[model samples]
Target: MVHPIKVQLNDLMVKREEFEADVSLRSERLDAAGVGLHGSLLDKEGYPRADIDIMSIRTDRKRIAELTNDHKSVTNQIEKLIQELHAATKDSKPSHDRPSAPAASTTDKPPEQSNGIAAPVPAGRPVHAAQYSRPLAVVDGVSEASPASRAGIQVGDALVSLGGASWESGTISLQQIAAAVQASEGKEVPAIVLRQGETVSLKLTPERWAGQGLLGCHLRPIGDTTRG
Candidate 1:
């Protein structure tokens, strides 16, 4: 029979997965809004640019706020679950094996001091599956004046989904995104990305822009240390 703690951990894992998905979506939205606002709605100093769309920026900001709250709520829930799991495991430890203090005796000479001292035990770090899992592709760089740059595909943004497949769907990948672009033949392809804790949708048209590749961006799988 599965242990009760194991079941609880599994439940927490499922909840965490859901939270991750939500966080990625919110990040994308935030990135898209920021891209839209860059130069168009705000100047370098953050003052309103000439011909700025105040209404559009306001709407984007409101959405970002709502998404931020949602992301925070889910994150707090995940942390609480992790803490509870730690406590549960700690409580499950057998108390009988715990060391007892030695009785004081008149002959005891305050325990002989040792010349060599043991190293201090390091604190245990919280372990979460999310820490090791790569659920999306990361944009490492975007060429200037390229199709991707013009479409607001910024570096550090996580490509969570493309062409209707998402990381949550277990099939999203950089190669899949490239294939979607090639299949589009210069048409607009819908993409969902995670940027700064929000989900944002973008219409990416892979065309021969003033760059090397159609997208003109360097993409690496999340958790991949090597460049491609």
Candidate 2:
């Protein structure tokens, strides 16, 4: 027949097993954090960026309670073992040679910034050419030191020709001609433009400029009302 002490030990062992099972279940839940949930914001690559919601905290609280209860039960079992050892070593000094526990880790993340608003670009593409080829609606704040400004191009000038080579009106852009001019050696290039409803000509030369292509002028499209 099984002794009474043996039955009592078996019951304690079952309780320990149950505590271990609870720990394992809690670990599994933590590993599957935020499963199948939509995030509050999208990141630069258009993937969902997880945000901490109060509901997620509530979920974590339940797991933490389970973990705490399991830990308390295990600690009680350890205390019982310590008491038994104390009795056995009554004549001896308690060993102070136990390994120190490691410090728990914490990661305090900084607050996230909002990326929901899409800011509009002023023009379709930024900064167009003033060389006589393409015309863009002249907006206010067009630079005065650009090539367009030096060539008698006003804020209301429409491009017509460059070095006598004509382009389809409004089909060419300022950037393409500027790029070509950037690639060229210093020379006086003939240009034609329509300003205030009159066609005019100018010869322009690029200096070995310090900054990215500076012309000594500013201009705007002829029909643009935004120009000051």
Candidate 3:
């Protein structure tokens, strides 16, 4: 029999994923249209960019922000569930073949903590993304003075999960990540990346900077590589 809290956690995760997907789709539309939240929509001479659809961009940005807030709320609930489950497990009699529940990682060393979860990776494969069991996107470039660099995300880092967007039985879903970022602007989103054979957990706060996109980094789906 499964614990009720675990079932609740699963439901919360599903809710988070729905928020993630919605954010990704809206964010992708904004990207395709070459617009961003809080960025100048005006062109030279102070006129709105003639090539863009101003209203649609605004709508997408607004929805993304709303979803981001909702996602965070759900995540907080999930964290509380993890803690509750962890405490309960700690007091129970030990079993030789016991089940583990997800718990918050320690601030000093997130990777070493949280054994109640799944896989970890760095480059080729995520050495579970914390907030994933698989990566939907991989960090291909982390420019200087950008959010990605600030967050400790490096080149060739394969994200097992970010902003609650993930894949099933497969790896790399750029769409999920695109929505994840869109919905997570100005918010510290929990993520896990595979870095050099180690699972490095971090929080990526997508925000506006002096670079492109909220992250200022390029994420490519697995099998998609940049040509030199």
Per-residue CA lDDT of model 3 for 135-171, tens digit only, reads 5555544668998889888655666666544453222
Ranking by lDDT: 3, 1, 2
**Tens-digit per-residue lDDT, 1-228, candidate 2:** 643433443455456556656656655554465432222335578765555343654565566577678756754554354334334434343455422333333321111226422121121122112322244323112234555455555433444554333343322455544554565437666555554333466666655554334453322333332332
Residue 128 of model 2: what lDDT? 17
* Top-scoring candidate (TM-score): 3
Output the better candidate (2/3) by TM-score.
3
Model 1: residue 143 alpha-carbon error in angstroms: 0.4
Count of backbone clashes, every candidate in sequence: 17, 12, 14
RMSD, one per candidate, in order: 20.2, 35.4, 15.9
- What lDDT score is found at residue 155 in candidate 2? 32
Rank by TM-score (best first): 3, 1, 2
What C-alpha lDDT does candidate 1 achieve relative to the native structure?
A: 0.54
- Whose lDDT is higher: candidate 1's or candidate 2's? 1
Instruction: Score residue 66 of candidate 1 by CA lDDT.
Output: 65
